[model samples]
Each structure stands twice: as C-alpha cells, then as structure tokens.
Target: MKPALESSPGNPLAHLPFYYLDNFHRVLDWIGDRYADLLDGEEQAFLAGFPALPQPSRALFVRMVMRKGQLFRASKLQYDEIGCPRAAAAPLADAGWVVADPAVTLDELFDLLQKPEICRAFALPAGLKAARKDAQLEALRAAHDGARPFSGWFDGDAAYRIVAKPLCDRLRLIFFGNYHQDWTEFVLSDLGVYRFEKVEFADAARGFRTRRDIDEYLQLHACRERFGNGEHPADVLHDVPPPGTDNEWLKSRRDKLLFQLGQQFEKLRDWAGAHAVYRECGYPGARARAIRVLEKDERYGPAWELLQHALREPESEAERQHLLRMAPRLARHLGHPRTAAGRLAPPRRLDLALPQPDGDWWVEGVVRDHLCRDDAPVFYVENALINSLFGLLCWDAVFAAIPGAFFHPFHHGPADLHSADFHRRRADRFAACLAQLDDGSYVDTIRHNLVAKYGISSPFVYWNALDEDLLELALHCIPPAHLKHAFLRILQDVKANRAGFPDLIQFWPAERRYAMIEVKGPGDRLQDNQLRWIDYCARHDMPVTVCYLQWTQQ
Candidate 1:
C-alpha cells in the first residue's frame, strides 16, 4: 500500500513524522513526469516495485537510504511507528531490497560491535578483555582476513544491508543535479531555515537530458571519491573519462576532479605526471599551475613559450599576475632582455600603532572599533557589503531561469556560475540590470530588492552582514560611478573577483564619503588576490587605503 504523509494536525508543512517518505515519493513522481526518458531498467523496476510494499516497509527502507551507510542493526532501529524493526525489515529483505546475510569485513565488524561483544564473539583471551575497543579489534583482525555474516559472528544477531543505496543515490543526483545536497534540503526548506527564489522552469527542463549525462556524472563522482580515498592519482586519472561536451555543469565537475588529480601529482613531486594532467585540463588556474610545474622541472624554454601565449590572452587577472611574475624570471633565465609587465602604483596608506585589545578580539574588529566616530562609523565588512549590493542589484540576471542554469528548486545560485559561458548566456539580462546604474535608477532597484528578497539564499549576499541602515548609508555615501566600476570588474570574473575586497569600510554620513581599508597585523602579509584587488582600486582612482598596524607596548 502507498504511504501517506503524516503531518501534525492543522499544519501541512510542519511536524511531518514521515517527511522522508513523502520527499522520496515526490522525487519518484518528479522523475516519472520529467525524467522518465532517462530511467534505465533497474531504476524503472525499483520505482514500480517501491509502492507495492507495505507503508512501514517503505518508511523503513527510506530511513536506511537517507542514513549514513548501508548496514543497519535491526535491534537498534526502534521507530515508534514501526513497532518492530525486524518485521518491517522482513518485507524489504524478502523483496531483495536489502541483503539478509551480507559479508562483514573486519573493518565493518569493528565498527558494528562493542569490545565485549567482539571479545565474546571471537573468544579473545582474558588478558585482552581490559584492552580498548581498537586494541581488541587489532588483536583479532589478523586472524580474520575473511568476512562473515552477522549471525555467524554473534548468535541471534541481526543486521541488514540496503542493496538499493546506489539506486537511491542516483535518484538523489537526478533530483538535486548534484550529490552534495541530500534529502535534508527538503527538511530545511520545510522548517523555513532556507527560502529559495521562485524561478519558472519549463516542462522540458531536466537535470540530465540524456542517459549518458547521468552515467558520466556517476563516473566523475566515483573518480573524485577514489582520489579522495588516497588512491594513486595515476590510477584515478586512468578511470576519469574526458569531460562531456554538451553539459558545462558536468564538465565543470570533471575539470575540478582532474585539477585535484593534477595537484596530487604535484604534491608527490611527480612533475611529468602533473604536467600531463594540467596540459589537458581546462579548469581555471590549470595553465598557470602547469607553467609552475614546468618551471619546477627546469623546462624554461617550453615554460617561456607557453607563458608568452598566456600573457597574450590572459584568462583572468589572477593568471595575468602569475604570468607577469614568471615573465621577468623566465626572461632572465633565458639570458634575454628583461620583459616588463606593467604594474599599478600602490594605493594610499594609513598607519596605526594601537595597544592590542584583549579578550580574543580579531584584527579587523579591533581596527573597526578604533576608527568609528560619532559622525562616521566603520564596519568589518570584508567583501560582504559590496558583494551583497551587487547580488541585490543583479538578482534577476543571477537567478534567470536559463536551461541548465537552474535545473532544480533548491539551488542557492545558478549551476553554471563558474562556467565559461556564464556571462555570455546572460549578457542581455545582466546588461539590463547594470544599465540602471547610468540612468540613476539603480538606487531604487537595489532598495526594492533589499526589502523584497531579503533572507533568500544567494551565492553573494551575506544577509547577516547587511542591515537597512548600513545599506542606506552605503547608497548615500558611495557614488553610483564607484558602484558601476566595482560591479563591472566583478562581471569580468565573478568567480575570482567576488572575494579579496578590503577588510573594513569606513563611511561618513555628513561628508557623504567613504574609504575602504585593508588591515594588516604585525606578521600578516598581503596575499596575491588581495594585491590584485588593491591594485584594481588604485587603477580606477577609487578611495582605498592599506592600514599597517603594530602592537603597542602596554
């Protein structure tokens, strides 16, 4: 019999006792409507058979699938509704949805049993009785290289292995378009912990359009897991197939896995292996990373050749910074004339030597307190204020319901936010949003969104860091030209430029002026990204300052 949603009286969305089962059913129904073409024989069979099981049985299976692992102890699973765990599991086991007698290795066995139970099961000596659980397992592990059933280990013991976990995980992937989010998203939404923007999705929209995309996603996930499990990079790379040409999202996943594999090789000092991985990798920073590896390998000639090509058409300011730093050294090593990549002049500076505050105060907070006056106040707004302003201003373009941009309802932002074609795809929408800046309509647009879309999940907006007073102060003090300049730079490279803003911003209400400050403690040095941002602000003649602080002797 089909299970029903058991919500508390008078509250359809709250107090759902069987919310997981309801969520699972929603996924099945969604797949039946939207992704029926992508389901294979196994998935088709599982969906067809799932509803015919008893309600308690379906609930029990979902409990196992949503849980951490496949193996569940029948004695421990005591749901109030499922009176007896063993009885509920019987239907699942009989239907072959769960393994009745699965092999349990020493590692698995160690995790499942207490020390006393393990000792009693394995008949360890009396002296080993006082040892720790790990000690006892290690003592008996050598004798048992083989796996045995739970009943074989401890008489009258019962455990179950959900054989449908792989299929369930695939269903999750299909619903969410990624494995990072699980059924907990439903719970969080129901509880009002998160509120996503409503975007219209066409009936044709599916996370995976073809069956091959689904298979490739699974393969990429496996390769990532293998690499993370400390498997050899070369072995993982051998299994990682080439990225899908059609799906930028899947290609992004593949690129990240390949980039990580390359970094692993670099960590092992496998220069040749690292170069091989980076040469074919199209992930951001791959080219600069490959050049660094070539330099490490002392291949100055090839490094210089590739470095020249990169400098001609630098991917982002980050890559340009790396290539510029490399140019002088590489040119010097080649015994050629010095090459000069234009560098920006340093911005204005502010120096302070204040007694360090007590009670675990951070550097930014200390500086903020020191700088605030009655007429002017400083906020420790590290990239939040500016990014939040931009997020509010461009909400339409960011959440535009383009194909593949948003495949699911729970997305914090677009799936292809970092894809190469992200800007190209939404050029018109973003252009319309940014056009308001020139015509003096941006203030109204941003103010409207701040009130309308507040507390909604966003990739850039930090709701906690912004209040109406602070945003109003920024809008009044900061000029539209400055906002336009900052937003333009962000649009150039959203992934890289979104961060690395000044640590603190001081606003003057009466004077209608503001200055961004990058604070540095005694030993803290500026990172490359920070230097790039400071230089960008200087280049645009924006009011910015780098503050150097030294602890005073009390």
Candidate 2:
C-alpha cells in the first residue's frame, strides 16, 4: 500500500521497503547520539550490540516491540518482506534480545489459542465445548492455572518473548519525552497524518537533566501501571517514589499519581487513607479532595481547618469554588458567625420552550438555532472560540524552545504545560504576548499566527471549530480588555480555566456588540466552573446570559 504523504519527494520513507525498521533505527541513533549520558550500562550494551545484529533480526525484533504484546507466535509472524519469521527470529533469540520460551499465565495461554486449539489441547467436555472463551478458561483454570512456558502447555511452534521490551520502552520514553507515543510517530509524520512544528535545540537541551530523573520516571510509571491494574491504593502508595526530586516535571507526575490514588481511596470509602494520600499530594485538586474526604467522614473540625488552608490560597478556581461551597455549613458546625460573601446578581435569564429538534441534535444546538437571527448570529462555541483565539495569540510563547519543553519533534505542546511553574518558566514570553492586547498590536499578531502556525497541534487550538469569518468577527467584537481578562484568567489555571466559557456567543456586527449565552436544558443546573465564569463575567461587566430550555413537546 502507498503511504499517504504531505510531500512525497521530501520523504525518505517513499523508497524504503522497510520503513518501520528505518524509523526504529532513527530513534536508536538519536538516543545514542543525544542521550548517551542518560544511558545506563544495560542500555549502552543494547545499543552497542544492536548494530552487530543481522538485518533480519533487527527488523523482526523491532516489529515485535512495536506490536501490542510482548509475545508473538512465530507461525503468525510471517512477513512477505522479511522472508522466514523463524529464521529472522533465531538471531534475535541467540542475541538474548528475545526469549524462545518465556513463561505465560493460564490467561495468556487462552489468549494465544483459538477455541479449536484449546479444545484439541485440553479435551474439554462436550457440555463445556460450546461455552464462551472466558468460560472455557474458567473450566480449565483449576487444573492449569499457574504460569508456564508455551512448550510446557501446547507443544506448538515457538513464541518469541521480547526480553528487551522494558529497556526499549525507556529508550522510547527518552526519545519521545514520555511513554505515550511510540515508533508510529515517525510513520505518521511520513504518512502526512500530522505535521509538527519543528523547534531547534542542541543535544544538551534534553528532557531529563540527571540519570535519577529517568529512573524515577520509570519507577513512577510502574507504580501507576500497578495501581491501574487493581492494586490497592495503600499498596500502590507504598511503591510510589517519594516526591523530593528537583525535577519539577517528574515531581508533577508523582503528585498527580498520588492525587489519583487518593481518589481511588475515596471511591473505596477508606476516608483516612484518602486523607493521608491527599495530605502529601501538592497536585492541583488534592487539598480540596482532602477537605471533602474529611467532611465525608464527619470529621468537621479538621475539614474546616483544611478548608481554611485551601481558601487562603486555592490552587485553582475549581478548588476555590469547592471551598466556598463547604464554608458556610462548616462555619455553622464550628459555632462561628456565618459570613456570606455578597453574591452578584445572576446573569439575565432566557426561558424558551422549543419542539424536539431533528436527528441527534443536542440541547445547546436547539437553543443556538432558536436564538440565532440574520443580524445577530450565535455560534455554539462552548470553550472553543476563546481558547482558539488565545492559542493563536500566544503561539510563540506556548511553543517556545525552552529546555525540557520541546526536546522531541512530535510534541503537541510543552511537556510541562500542567506543571506548577509552567507560567513562571515562560513568564516573559507570555507577558509579551498578552501585552500586545494592551497596545492594540494583538489583532495583527493573532492574524499573523492564524496563518503562519495553522494546522500545527496545540493544547488549546480547536482547528476544525475555527474559520476566517469566526476569527474576524471575534477580533472585532471582543473588547481588548475582555480578551486580556480571559487570557489572564487562563494563565491562572491553564488546566482548569480553559473550560467553562458560556456556551454560545452571538455577534452583532452592525452594532459592534456581542453577548455570551450559556444554555441549560430542562432540570440541568450550572456546573461550578460555569458558575465561576459567570461570576467573573459579572465582576468584569462582560455581557453574559443564561438560557434555560424546556421541551414544548416531550
């Protein structure tokens, strides 16, 4: 099959018969050259030994590693391009990169065999022969539960165990800046599925600063994986690496994992354990979770204390909203005089009753259609328009070539976009971008970026949702002050505040005025983040309204 290409002549993969092998080699070369210092003894040995392996062995090993599982049946691995699968794998087995007979659990055995194969090998009773694969597994499990090599069970052809998977996974992590992406990134780029913004940097500008960082990242990843696989929260917490690392990026990951463990503890209704996990976690929403957990257990005084601490400096607007909701009742519990912050008058309300709309139309769409007019048109922007505008204006700042941010070519955005010090690291750059709004330079800057940086991946840009008319309308309609306010608020909590904008924005081009409307269907209530945005709009005197919808015919 011909791989799709953005520009065929420019791609080296165009002529390559073994494109995946080439991509894998490129990653190995990049890591060996750029991250030589980070490579430990085993990794270095693997890199040194890889070059001496036969070409077929290298290609076969990479194919197995890129696939879903660690085990590959030799018979099933037939490749027209690679000649004989068994012949190709023999050198890899000899090189100690793959195990010819690795242990497999009963479940793994079941997964490896078809029903007929299982029936032939195990001789299932006729009554159980027609059952589901899992039921067959259960029936056979009592006699054949323990892990054993494939040869011990089936007496079938060989299965290759990728013994080098963990080592290669770490190398992949270093090359891609995380474990999420794999070798297909190069192919995707080659196939024109994505076009990344290339940022220039020396080899010294890699993501990991010290060897400890790499080890800690792998350790934490293992812990996360173990927890995800139904390990107890307390047990997972015990395995999680302690959080004193100087690498803020790794530290952020550690904190998020702890926060997630705390949440799992909450779900398990182990309140004390949840509180314990949350106490050490400095992640964005940890303190709020701790407060809520305390409240759930009716430990009112401690909950009140923690709530006060969170209220003093809430990490996010979402956390602040949660704290405010807890305060009055908690204050009453403590016999303290209830002090209620004055609530602003709510946004103007629109009540509408409309017919059930045509195929698969949502409530927001229904309201948008009903309210839109020839002169004043409404777009169901939700969070897209403002975020797209912000992303365009701050394109340079967001994609800045800071060390540890853009180590790899395929980054959708900075690796540390959610880290606590993300803004502080790029303070000057973001300041410059936001300052353009003040001097009226933003219009031209945003317009320029919209064209220049078009189609590149961004955390904030919704490319499909934006068009020229929408951009021009927003540039003219949204006041510079309003845009600045929204940008600054986003800077406050990029992770949380990007959402919760009013649902629809109506533009009145002739009048040069606009209003943001948040639509709510029957029985629906405003979410906390939405309420926070509404409160913000009220304080800033930005026109916003809440439209409540009811079905005229149900």
Name the best candidate (by lDDT).
1
Model 1 C-alpha RMSD to native: 3.3
What is the lDDT for 383 in model 2? 96
Q: Please give, for residues 488-546, the per-residue lDDT of candidate 1 as tens digits.
A: 88888889899999999999999999999999999888888888889988888788999
The C-alpha local distance difference test score for the whole of candidate 1 amounts to 0.87
The reply for model 1, stretches above 4 Å from the true place, is 1-14, 119-125, 139-145
What lDDT score goes with residue 533 in model 1?
Answer: 89
lDDT of each: 0.87, 0.86
Runs in model 2 with CA error above 4 Å? 1-15, 101-109, 118-156, 202-204, 297-299, 341-345
Q: How far does residue 238 in candidate 2 sit from its true spot (Å)?
A: 1.4
The TM-score of predicted model 1 comes to 0.94
Q: Best by TM-score, which number?
A: 1
